[model samples]
Target: MMFAEGHGLHPGHENLGGHIRFFNLDSGIFVRVRLPLLTDHCVLDSVEGLLVLQRDEDTAIHLLHPFTGDIVELPPLTSLAMQLKTDYTEATKLKLMRHISASISVADDGVVRVMVILIRMMRAAVATSQDTEWSMLSWRVPSHYQPLSTGGKQYLVHDTFFEDIDPDVAQVFQMEAHLQDTPKLIVTIPREILAYPVYLVECDSEVLVVGHNDMSFTHLAVHRLSDLVSERYVPVKGIGDKVIFVGGRALCVSSKILPPTTGNAVIYQHPRELTFSQYCLGSSTWSLATDECSMSMSGLTQGPCSLIPHVFTCCSRRHWNKGLMYWRDNEPLTWKVKQKFRDGVNHSHDPSLISPTRLFS
Candidate 1:
């Protein structure tokens, strides 16, 4: 199952609201689930089927299970800012402006672990199921660190190097643990690729580092990190039989599990539309995922939208034969797009000029 959560008109602009939409890839069925509490909050990330939502007013973060309607409140952003000796107002503004990445994992013992990276400050906070508050951890690396999720575990990668954080200290906050150890460099980025804006995606235990060029095109480099000292980066020409979804988080899956057409492709969001485009790795070209693009404008006129790719699963392996499912939701418009023209030609659409008639009635 794949799900998308976004705020938009419910079949019409008569009512604007936020909803968690579920798409059954196999059955081609779409269901919209309303989330009232998250109506005004910003969804930072989704992991293990739970959304990390931050309240706009207070910068309070919470875990929301859209399907079960379960909410777990974490320590407010003010607490984290205080730990860094930063002003709360400025911290809030920074978070809203930047793309904040987070990772959520559930241990075998049922303990929920969450790690949120504050890009601006180069700091991170960890919250566990047993914690009453979030524990702030500062990164010693010069370049900013990005969080990656794979195999129910979270890892951080800087420019071209994988930085290993102490797992023992990550679970339980020990101030002394910060001085006891240093980050170990695991893999190095290939000299041929630009290292900035790199994204780490774990597929079937193999780590794939995707480097995005200035042209918005991507190159893939694979590595096996099972042994830190012996691991090395290997350049790959293509990803066989697997389609990767890249955005706030990178998800990799076998093409056999998804729709037939999605094989050997990378599904990523378009810069201008709420829709997604599939980049066929073999051809090194892109085409719209027409099925999903068709539903992008169903009830929306003009607004900012976000697509979250999710997979739903059942408890038993016997039921897994139903095949893999993908879901996505449209996010609400949070920023206004200013109309600008280049060379006396109208190059952009003004949200103010959007016609209500274009919305679904």
Candidate 2:
């Protein structure tokens, strides 16, 4: 969890520079660092590793690590505050300032990457400063990158984002990926791009189980982690929506109108339609008459909403008013999940829980 430090400047300081502090519940440690203060309560601006508080002409942007006491000043054009369209009024800018913190995940390798959203302000629109954003903007810590020990208190990773950046662009980190050359097949089924994946199971270190985007079927693919490369995409399966790895078996979610279950169980919302029949893997086919629904073995990060990166399982519960939202796996949940709602949450076993060689065993 992150907490904003108060009392740095003055009591009535509205746009006072702020700092981000993080609390590790597992270790019971609280660390704080100086950051750019918010300029406006409504208009918040964020980029890859920085946050800006903007209200009218008074704007303060700070490039700081919430987990460490590192700070830098970013060029105006590169901050989200300056990326807004020329026609945008102060009110609209305030309304668009959104949270930019991304969930972090650790892979079998020690590398950590943070996913972010990037706005190609110049590429999207010439006249207006407002622009469309891409989801792939991410920051990462290489596997070999080591953190500096701060005396006997905390270990701090090097702040690479603060080093150098172009002044004309705004980048946001929304997700992270490990850069180990672990060979693995990643298949994005057609049409399932927007749906909550049903599952992500494991068969072996070499085999993975996943659902299709359409939420209509499932499939399996095998890969050798040692064969992985950079900026590469490999297909794993098609027409599936769920994946799970239990013992030696991998399960894929399928709503196909087949033996046990009949009729297309997928519901659709325009532009993104569901799939049809799918080939499910891992578990033996069962008759729906047995009165069995899907049982997830993973935990969901519940919030005002939930974001599922790939098909896995339901979060502890539903969001305030939405259904199962987007998926986010391999990331730690906030204290709200652990403390405020303990009984309502479910913990999933990590795929790495077993030996990678177990697949061959």
State the C-alpha lDDT per candidate: 0.47, 0.25
Residue-level lDDT of model 2, residues 19-60, one tens digit each, is: 344433224356655544322211122222333322223223
Query: What's model 1's TM-score?
Result: 0.58
* lDDT of model number 2: 0.25
What's the C-alpha lDDT at position 228 in model 2?
A: 21
Report the CA-based lDDT of candidate 1 relative to the real structure.
0.47
RMSD of 1: 11.1
**Residue 221 local lDDT, model 1:** 36
* lDDT at position 29, candidate 1: 69
lDDT tens string, model 1, 21-97? 55653344677777776545655555566766666456577888878889877766655655666555643433432
TM-score of each: 0.58, 0.28
